[model samples]
Target: QLIVVFVSILIAFVAYTSQIFVLWNSLGGAVAHTFFVLAPFNVFIIFIYINYALTCTTDPGTVPPNWMPDQNTHFEVKRSTHTARFCKTCNNFKPPRAHHCSTCNRCVLKMDHHCPWINSCVGFENYGHFLRFLVYVEIGSIYLFALLSNRLAQIVEELHTSQIRPSATEATFLSINMIMAALVIICVGILGGYHVYCVTTNTTTIEGWEKGKTLTMKRMGKIQNVKYPYDYGVMNNLRSVLGPQPLFWLWPRTMSGTGLYFPIN
Candidate 1:
């Protein structure tokens, strides 16, 4: 989980830093450019985080078998439809929102795809970064598209105004730029589509299997259904991803009923 968060932060840093450098170059040695450039990046970062939060997975059956309400503890565990259940695949009880990832060798909460780019699982911890990356990536693509389009337009304008034919080197450069822009557009389309799917349905790739049409337990919490056992509200859902914290929803070993606890019918 920590690894996921670190990797995501790293990715965001790279994107923001690279854009800042570009803006600096465009500003031509103006220190004032820092403010103009950083503000949008900041806004983009927040936007990315909110978008990611909205689409994060909320697995219903992640509660483990050892879980039990602790009356002895200060916090009273509320009776709810949420139950502690077992995953045959994991061969142990799981916390809510946690799912077994064959690649990660353990379950992750609100698990998104294991991003090869980051070399880490996009789980609850770094979900914010994942979403940020998506947003920035789209922004970057748009930026590149505008840049290439403007260059092409300028070339066309030059051709119309002047009798000189296009030079071979200039044409080759334009061709490369067009090709790069096209690739970026395609990649953005695919990523944006997938992100949209994940957001409306609210399931990550690690949790996507449970979102199947048949309404299997594997797919139960993907939709916003009150009938589902673990329909915790937005706060719980968010905590489910970020950390159980005082709630002890994540793996709290010493705490009673950490892994699996019977549901209060």
Candidate 2:
């Protein structure tokens, strides 16, 4: 997992370096134009790294040891039973939306998933950082694609107009970088878009799966109904995950919550 993280960072650095090389050497872009283009790109890069580090290092909230729920408190029950949810493996009462992560060998609060790339469970505490990292990666991928496309077009134009061709090394580097950028766009587009939907709907990836299961059971008449209690409409749902202020939605900060309780729809 550490190797994967290191390799991912190295690839990002190489991609950034490749873009600079194409801008200065291959495209021969003007200094002013290059700086203007690189400014926002550099910012996005920094944001990506910052969020990635936070996501990797932050501790997703855990169930306090020897904790138990109040008898009168309404809690998510075990399947069709009214019993409070419990983790047999951890021998503790599981909070709402909490789940035991086999990878981490502990119960996590509102755990979405255990990401191998970061080697951490993304849960209530770190979800904001994870989402921000995805957003930055998506933006960076698109920017890289556009920059590479422009450089390629210029090379083509120069070839046709003056019969001037790029060196073999430059052409090879451009081709490789373009392919990588395209893959990043496709993969991250799907992943980031899915997470965006999850946030807007106030559903984690695990809960999404459980929702599907309940729907299927309802169709078979095995369950009377299915309900997700956390969805508070689109805007409120976004605020639940990204914080209440729209302006700071992109900032690295967790929403206010203990993760043991959540308001219902």
Candidate 3:
């Protein structure tokens, strides 16, 4: 996991460095144009690193030692059992939407999954940061791809209309950077898109799988209709993960809720 994190950072560093070099050299006297392109690119890069660091370092919310369910609030119990959900491993009451992660060796609140790149669980506390990291990565990669493509087109034009040709070294670096950007776009695009859907619907990856199972059982006439409790509505669900302020959704901040008790639909 550490290796993966290191490699991801290294790739970002290399791509950023190579793009700046290529752009500076290629757009010789167009300093204003360079700034125009780099201003937003740099912002995305900063956000990407910031969110990544937060996601890696933040605790994904853990159950208090010897914690028990509150009788005042409605709490989920073990399926088909009246007793509160419990983790034998943690020896503590499991909160609603919480799951025991074998990797972390504890129960995590609203756990989405264990991400290797960040070397942490995407759960209640860090989920916003995780999502921001993905958003920034995808945006930055797309920006890089556009810049690289424009440079490539210029090189091709120069070759066709003039005797000058781009240096082999620059071409090689450009190719590598472009390939890396494309991969990030495609991979992160799909991942980010899925998580966006999950957030809008107020569903975690684990709950999504459970929902599928429930549907199957219903279809087989083994169970009655079931509804996911967390889905308040499209707008409210988005606010749940991203916070109440739409203006600060992309900013670094913790989400609302105690992670132990969530409002139901």
Candidate 4:
């Protein structure tokens, strides 16, 4: 909790403070740079909160107590899929697409992966929030990286030419900002790409490894002709996570779906 809170505040502080340098030196000394910088920066922060709140509060959905398997479902699922669906830990029948997260100590319906960053399990109910968070975070990192690099370059040029000797504090601060941005880009960028691949293929982190195959072996598209069933289509798959409301895809809202039940195909 402390770490999460600290990081959030640090992000906001770094952004606003850095913008001070650019705006202070601009012609007429107006706040244009600061305002422009904060526009996307603030939007990104809003998404961060939205994802964090939803992921933290929403129940990932659990198997009902004393649930019974339908006779038809029993026969249709085949012995292999049906046999492994029971959770010995919970002593309950697991739903299709559900997996037991040892960290959570229970079966999470349509379980993705446990994300410690949000201090929550990113399962059925909160997968959309998690995914959206990744997207916005990656965007924010790249955006900041671009903005800060320009500032850093100017400082570097000044130092190289011996035009002005920068103070230790100013030098350290600028370098740290650029370094942090770079790390965010590399770390969050790769993570965001993986989630994007997951969305396109309808595979989660855990699901990709189970059933004896990693998703890297397969490609997702119209003509793949593979065993990935959850992918309805690109747009429909996106809507499944982002909700059906076109205008609200970027807004803060819970996604549509009963986490307890999902269509496999």
Candidate 5:
């Protein structure tokens, strides 16, 4: 409890007092740059919270349609016979895309890997947060790139004959920022690409790769019950990402023999 409170307070402080905000204020009222840096990050963090609290499935009660059986019976575990290793911390069967962090000793649903930076589990519930975070990260990188590029141009213009001498603080800050920018690019780029690929194929990372063979989704005109085609056309794709209110349980319903029944309210 103490640790949790301390960490939460720390995050609150950083989010409110970070250098990014300082830079935003110092950038001569460049609203575009400020938004470019903050919007994506803000959305991402918000999404994470949503996922963690609302949508991430810690229990494995139902097998989603994406789970496939393999030809090799030896390797293929029957769903009826299968039981996930119970996680004491989570107190539930870790669902697909779920992983238990050694450090936390808890199973996270739709696990993306433990992120120390966020000091939280990245799972299905919080997947939205992760994506939003990535979007922000990408935006932040672009902002930095633009800011640096403009500054570099000015320095070149002024120092045609000599190298610019940076103060110790400036040098350290620049180095750290550059490294952070590179890391963000790589991390966000890979995660975004993976998510995109999964969305197009109508699968999650755990369901797609863990089922022994990759499942290819037919380009169905609409996403499940969504009215529009699942193609990357702006209307269709954006809605899918920033989609309709997700099912309360994060899974959609299907018309059954009797009628439509929604497991989650």
Candidate 6:
């Protein structure tokens, strides 16, 4: 319920605040520019919601009872990848790269990290949608920043030159929009950059942390040293996660391979 409310408020704030400012700046020129430049954000908005729903609702994949690796050959599996194969809690053979999610109380394939904001674990099945959500938000927030900044600049230029002055209501609306735009851009842009790095480097937040932890554990002689696998170069890694088509990279869709097992470098 807390996550639901947070998501709801975020959506409402973005939609209502943006529309309010647009309506407030209803001059012919402003409306024309915004209609073309800002209207397309509606699609982005829809995508945000769609991706959010898919991420939260879609299971982060679980290994069934007594499940074995695929033997038939659609996805070739390397037996060497199955190193850490047991989960004491689930009392089952945990697949390679699978981790137990305490929140969901299950093992998630290619487990990334549990996101509290979304109230879900970002794992193989819905990782693409999670990335898409970040992309759309950054794009939309940046667009809003551009639009509002231009409007504010125009107002300031005219007022400073003694040509025209904005009314009190107009000034207030512009100020609010500017603040909102700044908030979105700063907050979303930095966060989106982290996700972008994760996608490019073929690592998740959890995986990155585990990499460091594994190094520490190995140094302390707690565990044998093991090299991190699953990196298939830069482009291949992106394609495997974001799908093949460049056009549909930002589109809401599933990734190329199943979440069960992944090919490694």
Q: Rank the candidates by lDDT, best first.
A: 3, 2, 6, 4, 1, 5
Q: What TM-score would each prediction reach against the true structure? A: 0.51, 0.94, 0.95, 0.82, 0.49, 0.81
Shift in Å, residue 184, candidate 6 = 3.1
- Tens-digit lDDT track of model 6 for 1-265: 5886788577767655655654436435456665775578777778878888888877777777876656542343334673446677888766767788999888888898888878888888889988888888777767666766776788879878977877676677667766876787788778888888888888878878978898998999988978667677778778888888778788878755557776656
In candidate 1, how many Å is residue 8 off?
A: 13
Q: Against the hidden true structure, what lDDT does model 5 obtain?
A: 0.46
Best by lDDT: 3
Candidate 2, 188: how far from true, in Å? 0.8
C-alpha RMSD of each candidate structure in angstroms: 9.8, 1.7, 1.6, 4.5, 10.5, 4.1
lDDT of 4 by residue, 47-78 (tens): 87677667677887777886656645421243
For residue 54, give model 6's deviation from the true position in Å.
1.9
Q: Which candidate, 3 or 4, would have the higher lDDT against the true structure?
A: 3
Query: Best TM-score goes to which candidate?
Result: 3
Q: Tell me which of candidates 1 and 2 scores higher on TM-score.
A: 2
The residue pairs in collision within model 4 are: none
Off by over 4 Å in 4: 20-30, 70-84, 160-162, 211-226
Question: Which stretches in model 5 have alpha-carbon errors above 4 Å?
Answer: 1-121, 161-166, 211-241, 245-265
- Per-residue lDDT, model 5, residue 38, is 61
Q: Write the per-residue lDDT of candidate 2 for residues 1-265, one digit (tens) a residue.
A: 6765794676576566666557666544666767787778778888988998889888988999988886666578886587889889999999889999998999999999999878889999999999999999889878877888988999899989999887776787778888887888899899999999999999999999999998999999988976788999999999988989999999998658799888777
**TM-score of the candidate numbered 3?**
0.95
Q: What are the lDDT figures for the candidates, one per model? A: 0.50, 0.86, 0.86, 0.70, 0.46, 0.75
What C-alpha lDDT, on a 0 to 100 scale, does residue 47 get in candidate 4? 81
